[model samples]
Target: MELNTSLDVVPVVSIALMGILLFVLGANVTRHRAIRGATGNQMPTDPTDRMFIAQRAHGNAAEYVPTLIVLIVVCALLSDGWWVQALAVVAAASRYVHALGMLTSKTLAAHGPLRDLGAMGTYASGIALGVTAIAAFA
Candidate 1:
């Protein structure tokens, strides 16, 4: 099968935005580590700690962002439907919301509305993207 060279702009923009968000979260973690390094706890174990929250926020984004981006890109390449674009936007937005929820929350153990919404959006969009890609073949 021939590849489509004319890629949709929506997925490209979405991917770029998500990449920026991931880097920002990563930098936040690095900043926290640097600021807290003098205390000799480079790897904080407390979920309530700000440093730990930053780490988890970045770590969580790291876990989900790449997979979502891959799915978005695959869907974009396979199909040029507007639904694919919507999925990319939702996936990226959900990740950002999740990171915001993680950073702003007092603790990681408890559920927050933003976190819950973001998780739901992420799961929904991810499944939709997968189905969209598979359906492209049918």
Candidate 2:
């Protein structure tokens, strides 16, 4: 079988960047937990406000990154069109927005407009990619 090089750049770069972001967020949470004197192997039971924010941000990324990766790969395989690349770009950007919103907000549950928009954008990109995949594979 032949290999396709088209549609590879954006998704690959996005995946790498997401990995870096996850690592940084994870480290942030870990360091904060240590600062709170919870250096044991187990997670902190009572996280501070900042700890909560970091944990939630990392947790959100852990939950969504895999799905984004899968969808991006599927989109790349199905087509290397502008829509596919746009979805990849939007997915990456939304994650940053969400992370920033989580970090800057008063609480994890009370994410600001950036967080809301990021979540919506993420879902929209995933949905668009799924539809595109279906249309291409069908």
Candidate 3:
């Protein structure tokens, strides 16, 4: 069966790309941990710099991507407009920026400019998207 033309593709495309990114980040963490001899029966709680950054980047994406996907899908299903597409773009960009920031930071918890901006963008976009979905359905 052919894909529905009216079904928005933005959310699918955006989330797919984010999934790839998250996979790459996870791979990087695994590779670094293995190279550094940090892997064993349990994951390293205090990993090396590269491992820590990659893990955080991947973990952060894991935390947010599902929610973003849900919001985008709901918005696309319930509404007929550009808002869903726009939010998908915002969510994707936010995750990329966040990963970049996470990888470049000296400390995962420290406020790097890109990290802060990306986090704020993610939160704002997510909130707006959730609200939009509610408005669309309600």
Instruction: Please report the TM-score between candidate 3 and the true structure.
Output: 0.85
**Backbone clashes in model 3:** 0
Instruction: Write candidate 1's Cα lDDT for 10-127 as tens digits.
Output: 8999999999999999899889878877776888788898989998888888888899999988888888788998999999999989988999999988989999989999999999
Model 3: per-residue lDDT, tens digit, 35-87?
87744533545543567667778899899988887887777777767877888
lDDT of 1: 0.88
Report the candidate with higher lDDT, 1 versus 3.
Answer: 1
Candidate that scores best on lDDT: 1
Q: Which candidate would rank higher by TM-score, 1 or 2?
A: 1
RMSD of each: 1.3, 2.8, 3.7
Q: Which candidate is the best by TM-score?
A: 1
Weakest lDDT window of 10 consecutive positions for candidate 3: 39-48
Clashing pairs in 3: none
Which candidate do you rate higher for TM-score, 1 or 3? 1
